[model samples]
Target: MGPLIRPLRSFANGLGLAWWARVQTHGPDVTYWFGPFVTRGSLERELPLFLEDVASEAPVSIDHSCLRCRRGEPFTIPASDG
Candidate 1:
């Protein structure tokens, strides 16, 4: 299942049917898109690890959601400090 996840995710992403973790953080004011998961269950299972890594940075606040949608390049979007 682990090995197959990558290829399955790729296929689903190609068809614009992939699951994604949309993580938003305050303070730094950034939005990070983390995944082209083939299933929502898989995304949910893996979200905590990603969140933990991000939490290490110490953002003012954190918010997240699971989304099934197509996404392109440049997964990281940081809000302008200006």
Candidate 2:
């Protein structure tokens, strides 16, 4: 099942139709984009691990949202807007 889905996920991601987790951490003031998941469910399922990994950095706050949109390189960036 996983092997079969990789290609589809890549295709959807290329077309800007895949799901992603946009995580924002306050202390370091960074935003991390964590996926090109084939489905929202898969993104949701895998989000906790990503969160835990970031939490280990001990940021002052953490926030996130799931988006189905296109994003390119530089998965990690400074929180520029607010």
Tell me, by TM-score, which candidate is best. Answer: 1
Model 2 scores a C-alpha lDDT of 0.92
- lDDT tens digits by residue: candidate 1, 21-68: 999999889999999888899899999999999999999999999999
Give per-residue lDDT, candidate 2, residue 6: 81
At residue 4, what lDDT does model 2 achieve? Answer: 72
Candidate 2 per-residue lDDT over residues 1-82, each given as its tens digit = 7677888988998999999999999988999999989889999999999999999999999999999988788999996774
- Clashes in model 1: which pairs? none
Winning candidate number (lDDT): 2
Candidate lDDT values, in order = 0.92, 0.92
The weakest ten consecutive residues by lDDT in model 2 span 1-10
Question: Which runs in model 1 stand beyond 4 Å of their true positions?
Answer: 1-4
